[model samples]
Target: MIAALVSAGAAVPVAPPGLHWSACASGLPQECATVSVPIDYAEPRGDRLDLAISRIRTAKPELRRGVLVIIPGGPGGSGLNRPSTYVKKLPQSVLDRYDLVSFDPRGVGASSPVSCELAPADVTQTAILPWPGPGGDISPTVAWSRRAAAACAKNGGPVYDSINTRNEARDLDAIRRALGERQISYWGVSYGTYVGAVHATMFPGSTDRVVLDSNDDPDPALVERGWAASYAIGVEDRFPDFAAWAAEHEEQYHLGTDVRGAYLRLADRLDRAPLPWPGANPPVLDGNTLRSNVLNGLYSDARFPQLASLMSAALAGGPLPPTTAAPEAALQNTFAVLNATICHDVSWPRDLRAYARDVAADRKAHPLTAGMPRNVYTCAFSPGPAEPPVRVTPDGPPNVLLVQNLRDPATPYRKALNLKRALGDRARMVTVDAGGHGSYLDNGNACGDAEVTRFLTDGTRRDITCRG
Candidate 1:
C-alpha cells in the first residue's frame, strides 16, 4: 500500500493551458499542481501524502534568478491559494525574475488530511479555540479542552501525532529535492516565518535567499505560550492604527472623536449586553468574539472599516451580523491538525492552575484582549510526544533578507527584533513603519516592496530602515 501510494504521488499530471491558471481575488494568475511527500520522513519508504502546490511563474523566465517558495502563516493556513492572491502584488521586476511558488503543508488543504471528526457544537470556532471568560474564569475552558481532546483521541489516528513544525520543515525539504533544485529561496509570513526560520536552520545549505516577514520568537522553551502572550504587546502595538481609523471615520462609525474613548465605550457595552449575532456559538456577541474580531481586523487595515461598521450597528442596539461559517468538515479537520501540530511540536505546561494564574494576570494587563491569550486549549489537552525543537541561528550564508512591519498585531516588532538578533549577519532587516500582519507586497510601503523585489530579483539589499 505504501509503495503504491508513493508511486501514485510521484506521478505529476499535465495541465491544459488557460484552465491551468486563474486570477485570485488579489488579481494575480496562479498555476496549481500537486507534490507528493512522505507522510512520515522516518518512514520515507512507507506511505506518502500528496501536497497541493501552486505557482505563478515569473513573467520573464529568462530573467528569473530562481524559485521563490512562499510559506503561509498558520500551522493551519493554506499557501496553495496564495500565489494567485499575491502574484500581482509582486513588483513587476520581481515577477519578471522569479517563479512565485507556495504549497499547502501536510494536514492542510488538498494534502493528506486528518480530521478529529468533532461535532459542530464541540468545535465552534470560539469553543475550539478556548477564549477565557471575562474575569479569567476557566471552568468552561477546562471542560471544553477535555471534551475536544477526547474527541480527537478517539477519532484522530497516527497522523494526528505526526503533525509538527519539524515534520513540516522536513516535508519542505522533500519538496525542494523533488523540484530538483539544489537551493530554494523563500518568502514566509507570520507562522510561515517560523517555518522559514526552521527550514533555514535545519538545511542551511539548501537555502538560497530567504525573507521572514512578521516574525515569531523561536524560543524553544515556550513556543505557543510565547506566541499567545505576545498578543498583549501585539494589541497594544496595533491598537493605535485602529484608533486612528476610528477617529478618522468618526462621522461614519459614530464611535467617538477620541479613539480611546470610543474603544472603552464599545467594550463596556459588549461586556454589559452583547448584541445578538445569529448563528454564532452561544448566540450573542461576547468579549471573546470582540477580541477575536479585533485581532482578525488587525491583519489588514482595510477590514477596519468593516469592524467599525459592525461596532456602530451593535451600538445602535441592532442585531449583529450572522456569524460566518465554513464547511464544518473542513474546519474541524484543519483545527484538529493545527492543534496536533502545535501541541506535538513542543511540551507545554500541564498545570491547570498555572494556566489559570497566567490568564488572570494577562486579563488585568490587557483587558482589550481579555484572558484569551493565556486560556487553555486543545494544545495543552492532549500533547503528543516531544520532539527536538529547531534552533534558528545566524550561521548561514548572507542570502536572507527580512522585511517587517513595526506595528504588526499578529507578529509584533519585539518578536521580529528577537528573530533579527538571532539571524545576525546572515540577514539584513527592512523595518516598515506600518500596521498589519504581512509587510512585503501586502500592507508594506512601496519603498519596502522595492527593496525586497530588488533583493529577490537582483540579489541586492538596502541596509536601511523605512519610517512609513
Candidate 2:
C-alpha cells in the first residue's frame, strides 16, 4: 500500500530499513535514531534523506501494545522533545502499554535542514504573511512574496523544493517501518492530524488506534489554503473567549473595564503609532502584532494570563517584552516547511485582486484579525506545488477517533467537522465544548481524554460528545 494513487504523481513512496536505536542523554528516558527515506518518493530508488526519530519505550514491556506516534502540530513542529513534558500526563495504562514516540519531520528540527535564507526584513514574523498597507494596498506584500520566492528558489536547494505533505505521509510510513511495526497507533494534533489522515488514506493497513485531534479540513479542492481563509471566521468566533477573560479581570489589568472596547481601543492606538518594541522580530508592537500574539496565545487557556500580562504592560507603556519562541534555526526550518506544505498542497487564487477583495471584506467582518487570515502570503507566489494534493476520503482503516474542541481558533471546530464528514463512517467524533486548539490531554475535558485513552488502551469505541 505504498501509493494508492491520490495526487502526488503516479508514484507511491517507499521506506528505508528499520532503525538501530542509539543512547541519548536527554531529560526523558529515550533513544534517538535516523531513518533513511527517499528525498523524492516518486523515485523510491533515488537519493535518500534522513528523518530524525525519537522514542520512550514502555517500562512495562509485558503489557506493551505497539508503538504510538505523537505527531506534533506546525508543519514544522518537533515532537522529539515532547515525551519528557508529557511523561506525567499519560495514564499509567497508556504508559505501560505503548512506547510514546515522535520525530522531527523532514526539513524540520534535527532532520536534514533547508532554508530560503530570508533577509531579516522579510523574515520578520508579520512580514512572512501578506500584510496590507494602511489603505488596504497589497503592492508591498506582493513584492515581498515575489522576492521571498526568488530567495527560496536560490537558497532552498532541492530538498526544500520537495517538502510537501504528501511526501511527509510517505515519511511517516518510513518511520513506521523503521520501528518494525506492522501497524502502529497515532496521537496526532493540528496539522499532524492532516498527516495522519493522509497516511491512513495512503496506507490503510499501516494504521491502528488513530486519534486525530484539532482536525484539518480534508476538502481536496481547498486544502490548507481554505484553512488559511477559515482563520478569519475562527478569530471572530474565538475573540469573545479572550474578551470575557480580560473583562473578568479588567480591574487587575486596567486596560479598560469594557473588555471589547478595551481591546479595540488598544489595537487602534497601536495601529496609529506602533510602540517601540525592541528585541522582537518585527521590533515594533503594532495592532497585528497584538492580534498575532493573541491568536497564538488563544491556543490554550493556561496561557491566557501571559496574554493579559503582555497587554497590561503594553497598555501601561513598558519596555519591549522578550523575543524568544523557536530559535532562529528552528524558525527557519519551520518557515520553509510550512510554506512548502501549504503552497505545494494546492493551487491558490493567483490573481492579486482576488486577495484584496477578500482581505477588505474580512477586515470589516473580523477587525481583531484585521484581514490577516484572508490575506495572501508566500504560497501565492511559489513556483506552484511539486505534486497535486492527495485527495482524502472516508475510505480507510477503522478505530479512528476524532476529538475536537468546539472553538479552536487555529484549527477551528468547523474545519474539523469538515474532516469528520470527509472521513464519514470510517471515524466517530467526540466534540468537546472547550475553547482551544488541541484535545486529548492537551486542552480537552476529562471525558474527552478518557474516550481517547480508553480507545487506545483497550479499543473501546463509544462515539460521544462531551460538554464543557
Candidate 3:
C-alpha cells in the first residue's frame, strides 16, 4: 500500500515512492493508484493532494517503448477513465508498443476535487459560458461573473488557487517520477494541448513523442483568455460545414435553401417568444440555448443531425426537444476548476465598459455567437495569477507532432497555428481537411489518423495536410 507519506514535519522526498497498484473497481483491464503531490510546489512540505492515476500495460512487453500519457481537455476534464475508454480506439500497433496511462489533475474527478458550491442555475452552460443578453447587453453577464467569482473565492479554499496550467504541468512531472519512467509520451486534446505544451517546455527531456490534438494559442499575454475569445473565429470556420450540410438536406430539415438565414430568423423569433421545454434546466428553448446548441453541434459532423432536429422542431412548432441537466456536483466542480485555472492563470481586465465594447463589436461581427466569446468571465473578478504564465518555447527537441482539423469549432485552425508558431521547429503539424474538436482517432479521416498513428508508433516527422 502507498503509505500516508506526506505529513507535518515530514521531509517530502525528491521523488515519490512507486505507486501501489490494484485492479480498478470499474473492472476494466487497467490498474489504479494514488499519487500524492504538494498543493503548492514552492512549498513541498505543505499540504498535499491525491491524484488518481490509471494504466493499461502493453501486451508485447519486449517491444514496449514507453508510457503514453493521455492529458484530458478542460481545466476540469478527467483522464483517469481514459485508459479503459481509449483501449478500444487506439491502434493495436501503438498499443503493442506503449503502455496507456492517464490521471485526474487536481480539482478534477477522483483527485482532490474542488467545488465552488455554485447553485444549479449558476452552473448551467448558459451562465458559465457568458452569453450576452438578446440585444448584445453584457451587464447581466458581468453581474453573473461577479457572483460566481465571489462564490468560488469563499467556497473553493486553497486548492482552487493551486489549479493553474503551470501547476498541472508540475503534477505531470511528479507523475513521471512516481511511475519511475525516464521519459513518457503524451497525447493532449483541447485545453490539454496547452497543458501538454507547457509540460514539454518545462520538462523537455522528460517528454519523448508528443501529440497535441485540436490545439489552442499559447500566447503568454493571453492564454485561457485567448481560448475563450477564439470561439467567434471557430464558430465562423465550422458553421459553414454545418450550414453546407443543412443546406444539402433542406428537404428533410425543412429550414429552406437559405439554412443559415433561416437559423438566424428562428433564433431571433425564439428570443422574443421562447418555447417551453419541460425537463430542461431553465425549462425554455430560448435564443441563447439555440445558439449554445449550435456551438456544440459544430464540434462534430455526427452531431449535426441532432442539432438540425432541434432547430427543425422549434421552427415547425413541434414539441420542444428534451434536455438533461449535467450532474449538479460535477457541474459545480467543473465550473470551479474552469474559473480557478483561467482566472488564476493570468489577470483579466476588470473594466466592464471595455468588455461591453468588445461584446458589442463581436456581436455585430459574429451574429451566430451573439458575443458570448468576448463577454465577461469570472476571471475578471478573480485574483491575478500567483506566477507568470508559462511561455511555450521552441527550445525543446523536435519530437512534437500537432494534428489539427481545418474547421475545429472549439480550437479553430487559425488560432491553432499560433501554437505551432510558438513551438517553431520543435513541432510539426498535420492539418486535416475535416471539421471537429479532435482530429486523430476522431472525425474518422484515414489520412489524418494514419499520420498521427505513424508518429506515435514510431518517431515519424513531417508537416503535411490531409484531404478527405
Candidate 4:
C-alpha cells in the first residue's frame, strides 16, 4: 500500500529520496551509486551534494536481513576499497545474510573530493607527523599548520566545511535510506568507532547493530584531540610489543639484543647523522623519518618485519627500499579533508607556550613517540568552525558492541574502557588480550572476530575477555 501510494504520485513517505545504481568502475561484484544529501542538514532544501556509495549484495537473497555498512578509519580514510578487503575476512554466514556496504565519506574519495594543495615538502610522513628538530623546535609545525589551514580554506571550498564525523554519519543514514532500509548495522574501526558512536546517538532508532572496534573516547570536550594526546601513552603501551619482537629475533635483525634500547639509540644516532639515500622525497633517511615509518608499521603486526628490515639495512648500510609517493592531487585531497575534518570537528589548544611545555614534558616521559603525540595539527592553529561534538551516552538502544585490543597504538585499551563506561548498559564490551591498532579480522584474534560475527548474526551480547 505504501509503495502503491508513492508510485501513484501521491504525497507519500519513502527513503533514499532518489537512488540509481549501476556497475561500479572497480570492476568487482559491487554496484556503485551516487546519493544526494543536503550540504547543510539545517537547510535541507537549500544545497545538496553527491555521496559515493557501494554495495556487495548477498549471494543468498532469501537470507538477506538488511544492510551492513562498514565505516572506514581516518578523517581522510576511504571505504570504497573495503568490500574487497572484507571478501577475504568476513565469515561466509555474514556474506549470505546481509548486503555489505562501504563508502568514501564526504569530501573524501570520489565524493566532491577536498584538497589543500599543501607544499610537497610538507606532505611526507616525517614532515606531516610533527617530529621536532634537535633543539626540540616545533615552531615549524605550528607555522606549517597555520599555512596549511589557510590553504585548505582557500582550495577546499564549502564542501571542506562539510567534512566531519557528524556529516559523515548523516551521509550513512542517507545511504541507508537510499538502499530502502529502515535501519542499518555498522562495523567501524579506529576513527570509525567514534563515527559509529555519534551515528548511534544521533539516530538511535536508525541504528540496528553497531560494532565499534578500537574505540576512542567520546569525551565530547576533547574529541579527536584526545585521541591525538593519548598517542603518548598509546605508543608507550605498545612499544613493548615491538620490543619483545625485536628481542625474539635479535639474530636476524641486530640493531641490538636490548629490545627497546636498540631502537632508541639507533633513532638518536640517526638524528645526528642521517643516512643519505637515493629516490626518497627530501632525498635522505633521517631519524625522524625512520621513527615515523616505525610508527606507521606498528599499526599492523605483519608490517613489523618490513620495518625491522629497513632499520637493519640502514644500520648495516645496505640498499635503500623503494619509496612510493601518491600523486600530488591525491595527497592534497587527503590532507585537506584530514585537516578540515579534524579542525572543524572540535577546538584545539592554541597557546604556543603551553604546547612547548607539554612537548618538553612528553619528550622526557615518552621517548618512544618523543613529543610528536601532543604536537599540534592544523587544528591548533586553524581550528575551523567546530560543530558541537555529539555527546556519547547510554541513552540509545542496547545494541552496541565494542571490541578493543588491550594495547592499541592509536586508540588504546584505557580509552576504549572510557567509552564503554560512558555507554553503560546500552552496550557490551569485549576485551582482546592483544596489541594492534585494529582488533577484529585485521588481528589474528579468533575470539574477538567470533564475538563480533556472532553479535552481527545472532543479536546476542555478552562481555567477553579473550586471548590474543
Provide the TM-score for each candidate, comma-separated. 0.90, 0.93, 0.95, 0.94
Candidate 3 per-residue C-alpha lDDT over 289-345 given as tens digits, one digit per residue, 9 for 90 to 100: 889889989999999999999999999876976778777788888888888999888
Give candidates' CA RMSD values in order: 6.2, 4.3, 5.6, 4.4
Kindly provide the TM-score of model 2 when superposed on the true structure, using C-alpha atoms.
0.93
C-alpha local distance difference test of each model: 0.76, 0.79, 0.88, 0.81
Measure candidate 3: CA RMSD. Answer: 5.6
Evaluation by TM-score, superior candidate among 3 and 4 = 3
Q: Give lDDT tens digits, candidate 1, residues 1-468.
A: 111222211112222222233444334467666667776778789877777777888778667666788897787888887777777577777677667888888888767788888876776666655677655788888888888788888988876767888888888887777666667888998888889888988877777778888889888777766887888789889988898888888888888867655665676667677777887665677666676777788888889988887777777887676566667887787787778877887777778999899888887788767777788877677865557677778876776788888888877888878887887877888989899888887864878888887887667875677877
Worst 10 residues of 1 by lDDT: 2-11
Off by over 4 Å in 1: 1-30, 279-282, 321-323
**The best candidate in terms of lDDT:** 3
User: 378-401 in candidate 4: lDDT tens per residue?
Assistant: 877674555788898787678899
- The candidate 3 region of ten consecutive residues with least summed lDDT is 1-10
Model 1 / residue 18 / CA error / Å = 23
User: Higher TM-score: candidate 1 or 3?
Assistant: 3
Residue-wise C-alpha lDDT for candidate 2, range 1-468, written one tens digit per residue? 232422321112234445788775464577888989998888889988888888888999878877789887888788888765567798988888888888888888778888888876677677655556654567777888888878888899778878888988899888888777767788889999999999988887777788999899888888888788778777777777877888888778775656666676787788787888777777788876777788877888887888888788888877656665445665677788887778888888888899999889887887777787778787777888767787777776555899988888888887888888877777899888888888888774889988888888887776698986
Task: Provide the lowest-lDDT 10-residue window in model 4.
Answer: 2-11
Model 3 spans > 4 angstroms off: 1-17
> Each model's number of backbone clashes?
0, 0, 0, 1
| Ranked candidates (TM-score, high to low) | 3, 4, 2, 1
